[model samples]
Target: PLGYIKSISFICYPFAYGNPNKPKKMSELEKRQIEKGDLSCLINNQQDANILYKRIIKLYHQRDMVYLVKPKTLRYWLKSIALRDANEVFRDLVNSGY
Candidate 1:
């Protein structure tokens, strides 16, 4: 009763208000939108993009109070940062979970 409610709330609350740094859980419609989302327009190919998205979702499920920073956010992280290719970030994601 109370324990069940507590357990359920623990899972549901975070699902509702996920970590601010990561992408929020997609509704069925949003998932479809992402599945059909312009892969070429984003980073890397569909497969790599999907893998990184899955990793973000996994992080959302596994950790508490963790923040995720996107590759683009490096601008804010370091104003002097320079990169030759943006896809390198997603490539790293494929090679390493981050």
Candidate 2:
């Protein structure tokens, strides 16, 4: 169907139409920190923890991947996602956590 095709296109090509909302690119340091998501790396402050948590969740969502694992496993998963994917990251992890 036309709608189905359009949906697939939207997933594959986020800007299928005239929309010009290209995601902001993350810096190398920022990307690394996001992928790590290590609580230990986080500072002992609510702002730091909140920021890291949000990044990890956002990364997972943007990659269309779900990390249903423990803390260590999640770190591993996020690290891998960070190294591999180069797609523009967007926030889709809202209300799920973080």
Candidate 3:
């Protein structure tokens, strides 16, 4: 049956592609791969740098369109970016002797 709208009751929702709210089930190998990608990015390994970015794009329809990246790969990409930023901050703090 098609979804219907009630006369008095209404449901307001955000438009999202795929199952964004689904819980991700990551294998030990996948987890390690993501971490490895993060490390590689930190080390300036551009070859495997986009591994996580590709994965995240898979998770969402928007991302997988152009590059067709896997959700798992995209996640690693994101992790790497966050780690890179955090590392910079840490370095700055250390330099300041904080």
Candidate 1 to truth, TM:
0.22
lDDT of 1 by residue, 4-98 (tens): 11121111112222345654443556344434544323333246634542112112333322122222332433434323223443454457655
RMSD of each: 15.8, 14.6, 18.6
TM-score of each: 0.22, 0.21, 0.22
lDDT of each: 0.31, 0.32, 0.33
The lDDT ranking, best first, is 3, 2, 1
- Candidate 2: misplaced stretches above 4 Å? 1-22, 39-98
Distance (Å) between predicted and true CA of 80, model 2? Answer: 24
Query: What is the C-alpha lDDT profile of model 3 across 12-86, one tens digit per residue?
Result: 111232355642344456444443454323323234646532112212223211111222233434667657644
* Stretches of model 3 off by over 4 angstroms after superposition: 1-77
| Clash pairs, model 3 backbone | 52-73, 52-74, 52-77, 53-74, 55-70, 55-71, 55-73, 55-74, 56-74
The candidate, 1 or 2, that scores higher on TM-score is: 1
lDDT tens digits by residue: candidate 2, 1-98: 01111111111111111223544333456444444544332322346534533222222424333322223334534657654432323233344443
lDDT score at residue 3, model 3, on the 0-100 scale: 23
**Candidate 3: residue 61 Cα off by (Å):** 37
